[model samples]
Target: MSQTPRYQEIRDDLLARMCDGTYPPGSLLPAEPELAEAYGVSRPTLRQAIQLLADAGYVEKRRRRGTVVRRRKVEQRFMDALMSYGADVEAQGAIPATRVLQARIQGASPEVAEALGIGEGDPVASLMRLRYLDEEPAVLLRTWVPTSVFPGLLGHDFEREGLYDVFAESGLPVETVRRVLEAALPDPVEAELLAIDEGQPCFLFKSVGRAKTGQAVEYSVALYRGDVNTFTVTLTTED
Candidate 1:
């Protein structure tokens, strides 16, 4: 007897339909009761298949819109050179935009302080930005830099300017960035801003950037939508 579950069979069919344009990107799937009846399966079974699709980046459950097919995922290849997000997205032919949600001086938390080699509670220039790809919310960035290093960091218009360019122009360019990546879930507010469910998966990135003088210059945490984004890293066997 075939051990494959019925839901798995249904999921495969749905995926095939998506590939053939039977269910194009941004289109909503049929209502659960209607689809379940069409497939001769229980609602629970149908949902199981749908949930698998969501987890695999094939579809997403939108509030009041039901399940929606997703467009092609964004491919981010800047990690190898630690390039700016804007440049990377533009290289891939996608429109990039950033909105500065908050830009001000704030006390550095323990993690930020350690990354910046400063005392906890010391003043740091904090910036919270929402990044968009093709006008769709993609990543959230929260950054901290020591005030002594860049006192006028908050005076610039970040929405229209790029941070890397500003840092270089200020004579404190980011020479190196050490980062860590992990899979995680977003908080309620983060979910709303990303237009995704709170239970949806996310990629969390934490990094510390340093100048050529080996001085820590910036620390940041970034959250990326798992369903619509992907990352690539180039590895070599050279010392």
Candidate 2:
């Protein structure tokens, strides 16, 4: 048989080592020259293999730290269904909890009002929460909901469950949601709340949920630690 693809071979070998615990989390791997020599491949080829691992979220290359194994990937299911953040964590067998940092009725900003389809002066329930996964602060959530739709929602205890769960309990018809993900440097407040170092990069998610009647109900911005959480999406093609 023809020789296995070079990159594939290199990738498989490194992955096997990782799986067998040769390189545990936060452990550094061999340098480029050393890896190339051991793999009997050129430096460029070995570099490509390392890049592949980095893209798969298995390793991180720091300028001075060399290449180190990253923490295990968190599985994220992306189905065409509505699920709460708390429920999602529980499904993965991880303990989920939230610390409500702020909750009150506030006049909707122009941007928030437009997203929630409410007047600018309308009252909106604003909440800030720090979500923990397995005792680690994982995400910082800032959410706004139109008070006209669910009065007194700001008084509920969101530390025990997600806002989406409360909305479902109230018989709100949550039909669809739109989400966008991007990388950003955490602001001072966000960095402090998420327990990340100042100016660290994070994955920012902006999402809007709407009722079946096409009324926008929720507008939220969430910041997740890049080193701890990864957002995943699956797509199928129609021929």
Candidate 3:
């Protein structure tokens, strides 16, 4: 067998430590230089090893605190009935909360327009929020709804309510949803909002929700922290 790359070897060792409780969850690993010296590798190589841990949801790189063993990721099953982030987390025995960052009427971008089946530049209610699970930053969520579908949407308080609830209150029934999932590195803004090191991996979920009559009601994009959230998809075979 080919030799394991030096960085992978280091990463495996650290992962072993994490699994054995040598580095317990929420506990810090040794400082970078010390770890580097122990592994007989350059700091850059050590960092690569650490980055691998972070990307795999095993650890987090926090400023001033060093690398920390992460808690087990919260599992999000895509096959579950569509619900609010709060509901999803609560069902998993975690507390869920939201902090609205921005909520206002704005012109839809081309992407939003396409998703919502509206004209480009049409009026839409845009909402941005930072969602938390057990008081830890977990997801950065942005959603757009056509003003024509729900007028005065901006007048509602989203920090204490969920977008799905808002839609229901407006008598808009979501008939279908199409979603796309991908992995990406957080941009500077996302990194700041999520309290994660810049360039850390995140799970991006983008969806368009339509009303019963085929009118698109919502266009949403959510970024889940890679180190703390994992999604599962279930498939069934026909008899």
Ten consecutive residues with minimal summed lDDT in candidate 2?
72-81
Give the clashing residue pairs of candidate 1, or none: none
Higher-lDDT candidate of 1 and 2: 1
Stretches of candidate 3 exceeding 4 Å from the true structure: 1-65
Better of 2 and 3 by TM-score: 3
| Candidate 1 Cα outliers beyond 4 Å, as residue runs | 1-58, 62-65
| lDDT assessment of candidate 1 | 0.90
Q: After superposition, how far is residue 226 of candidate 3 from its true place, in Å?
A: 1.1
lDDT (10s digit) by residue, model 1, range 123-150: 9999999999878899999999899899
TM-score of each: 0.79, 0.69, 0.76
lDDT leader:
1
Local accuracy of candidate 3 as per-residue lDDT tens digits, 70-135: 887788865456776777778888888899999889999999998888899999999999998777
lDDT score for residue 148 of model 2: 86
Comparing 2 with 3 on lDDT, the higher-scoring candidate is 3
What is candidate 3's TM-score against the reference? Answer: 0.76
